[model samples]
Target: MCYNATTSATAFTISVLCSIYLIYSGNKTHNNVDIFAGIATFMIGLMQLLEYVLWKNQDCNWINKYASMSIPVVLYLQIIVFHIANKYLYNATSPTYDNVYIIMNILFAIYVICLLVWLSDQKLCSKPSANSCRLVWAPFEKLLNYKYGSYNVGWVLLLLGFLFYIQFGIPLNGLFYLQRSFSVHKHNYPIRNIFPYITIIAALVYTIVTDGKRMSDTFGSMWCFLCVSYGIVSIMHI
Candidate 1:
């Protein structure tokens, strides 16, 4: 099955509870990163629940398509926001921080527009079928489409954002702050430093695997699982 009801239900429940707790406590803490992370987590759980429901109905194209693609944008936002929040926690504000946040927001907006256009142009079907179902193309073909060059622009922005995130957010801010927050023996600083790189590597490997077989359900599931699991872990650290 494309979406297992049992598993999705369980995920949905846990995600909802997490969302409530994170939002409530995040407000108390006055942390934007945790707030956004909580929002992203809530969305993830909502998306999983929607996927489960839509899988049975099969006629809800717009909602399903948009929900699926919009996830990455929020996921990226959560990470960037986390970086800013972490900096606030440490009182390590930089002059360029606002500029970085603005740039990232612009890029995120561009990506969202591009993805929405791509999804809206899709050839949707009421029922899932080999010829009608476009699951594989959703991530590969649709996302990569260069019509109007928005896709290219989106990718450029995303790549630049990734570099900035790693440069300012992950290696310097994230690693240092996390190390300070947790004891040396309790937290593996080196591993934490490498986590972002690991995620990038995993994305590259998944892209290669998907390129070989776009329609492979197993590969897609594995990719989604890794990404979602990693996202959850990242949020927990916030």
Candidate 2:
């Protein structure tokens, strides 16, 4: 579980750094793009790490699986946006976006490969524990064809995540301003009220919609769990 272990440790580290910056930035780095990426980077990084290592051992380390597959899409999008909009936010290179993109892309590719191996085998849920890394080539003589359908129960879940992602940051700006506000007689520091119910819903939909043996199944399901769980955990800690 090197990936899993690394991801968890990395998430904690990034979260700590972001937390410090948020708490003690003293209005200095308030508009930093790197700062904005603090939570996004940590959440995806840690989640992917878990997915890579855990999947090597178990067919489904349900939580890690979601993180590994789904969060990259966000990371990819965030990096692109932050790089383009650095000044409005901050300088371009605070959080090592280059390394994040390169490393995440590689990790994403590996996890996909692992999923391919799993899909080729029929005995997905039932198996003995040790050293079960299957080959890239299919175990069965006939190759299994995987499909991603537009119409399904899974659409409901995707919709839920879409909504949460859009709404979660409404009061987040004020969260960074909390310390200064605390000294005042009355204050309304920004706050975000969010519950990641969509993440779970998405996972269920992915499960119902996709073929269990396909790599898409592994990634799609895991993505939902990681996104929501990471958000919930981060907010609670905050």
Candidate 3:
């Protein structure tokens, strides 16, 4: 998750290779679901590539504005891909869960729209390090502190908790239920069953290990990187 042009380019390359392999294997095996997963993988790679562009052209205002705008859309598309894949792979057609997905997408849409609107007046990009032009929510920091009070640890924790729950918790919860309901042999589905927990743990580790100052500078970028990078794990399902 290092925010540098080199690392971003490398991630994009790896994701591209992995996506090609996954798609080719899916085609040969006639597994349409795998194709969807491959597409998701490619989306993740696309995001990293966008980051690379932003890193390289940090001084270009138009490039930064459009590229920054594209990031949230790409991130949201990943969730849509997951929803489609879940339906095809697990036959997850439960109306309740479908409604949950719909609501989640709506909420995510509002969140993205609000963020983009809020950052419209300010530069949506940040140069956290000499070589890094990372997307961040720095513009919101002042507003958040002003609204919630400065040095409000509780508010930060609550905000992060909600973000994580929306980004990971709900989808994983739905997946967990779907897997259990669909699997023919429950005992054999260890990896799928525990994957959500693993993801949550990894995210927690990320939050704990990232430098606080760096986290403030690149909180949005860090979370997006974590989500996209971990998306490679979809290969396991494929």
Q: How well does candidate 1 score on lDDT at residue 47?
A: 46
Q: Please list the C-alpha lDDT of all candidates, in the order they appear.
A: 0.50, 0.37, 0.58
Candidate whose lDDT is highest: 3
Candidate 3 TM-score to native: 0.69
User: What is the overall TM-score of model 1 with all chains considered together?
Assistant: 0.54
TM-score of each: 0.54, 0.28, 0.69
Point to the candidate with the largest TM-score: 3
> Candidate 3, which ten residues in sequence have the lowest lDDT sum?
184-193
Residue 40 local lDDT, model 1: 49
Clashing pairs in 3: none
Considering lDDT, which of the candidate structures 1 and 3 is the better prediction for this target? 3
Error of 3 at 120 (Å): 1.4
List model 1 lDDT by residue over 102-199, tens digit each: 67667655755665566567753223335323233243344443445343653454455456545544333444445553332232334424554575
lDDT per residue (tens digit) for residues 1-238 in model 2 = 1224344354445555554454344246442322343444344444344444444545544443443344434433444343343323432233553465456545544544554454434333311223323212121111233325644433343344334333322122222222322333132223211222344345546656765344343343344344334443443433
Off by over 4 Å in 1: 17-47, 60-62, 65-69, 76-84, 87-92, 124-140, 145-200, 209-238
